[model samples]
Target: MGGLIFWKLRGSDEKPVASVQPPPPATTPQVFEQPPPPPPPPPPPEEDAGKKPAGKVVGVGGGGCAGECKGTAGATLQSALAAKAGAARGCYERGLRQNATLQGKLVISVRVGPGGQVCSAGVASNALGDPGVASCVVGLFRSASFPAPEGGCVDTQVPMNFVPKGGGK
Candidate 1:
């Protein structure tokens, strides 16, 4: 037949398909509001205006020198070196004797024991190449002594500049 016609059976074994539905309309998203932040804590109260602030007094020495004993470590080392300046000069003189043209700077570290005696000494920096000169300088420092520190030992580094006699500037 030119135009075909199809017939449907009502009581067939095949099941009917479900119909499709259109999607729901779009809507604005809901937002949950957050609570405000807590306030900052109050500052501590100021001290009494009439009363002076309490402070611990650190005494380097007894009586009159208590307050004037600033930088005791340095002062002690300096005084100790001053007491041994002559011997240190001698060591430098010896170095000069070895090499008439020897001129440079030497830095040495000295450790003062608890009993105020130099426990050890070593050259920290040396521009002078002579081992004899270095050893002489170290020996001079090792024989020096300093005032005993409050409770323990003290260490200090001293820098010495060497220049030949009659050398200018």
Candidate 2:
């Protein structure tokens, strides 16, 4: 019974002790801190950068700038007519806009230069609503002429409209 009691005393750890040594200091887990976020991107340059150019793009589509080509000193009547015809063909085909077809005539006014390039062009539709046709017509105008038109003028009536079985604006 004495031996058993001694063994029990040595084996036991839950019982209170008369003289107790302080427990080792507790250790806490290390923490990690996150880095700061990156800076934002810069903005784009403005359209009118203050020192204004002579003109801006009012309206444009399909190709180059409208008044980009400076009309040369003079242009021939033949060249003007040729320009008109070619423009007409392209306009006719492209006139087939979405879900609709149209037909009509218009007057195409162009200011040409001696170099045969079209300085500027305008279309007065005899019949309206074929936007595609007008676009195609203008597409023909771009880069088509060589020498510019003569100072006087060349005005002609052109059929600027949509046609049979194609599309609408």
lDDT of each: 0.63, 0.51
Pairs in steric clash, model 1 = none
lDDT of 1 by residue, 75-160 (tens): 66677676564456677788787778887777888766545656568999888666777788888887666776544556667777
Candidate 1 has a TM-score of 0.51
Q: What is the C-alpha lDDT profile of model 2 across 17-76, one tens digit per residue?
A: 699789998898888777777777555446455322223222222222333443233335
The C-alpha stretches of model 2 lying farther than 4 A from their native spots are 1-76, 97-101, 126-128, 151-169
Per-model TM-score, in order, reads 0.51, 0.42
Superposed on all Cα atoms, the candidates' RMSDs to the truth, in angstroms, are 16.3, 11.2
Candidate 1 regions exceeding 4 Å error are 1-74
Q: Model 1: which ten-residue window has the lowest total lDDT?
A: 52-61
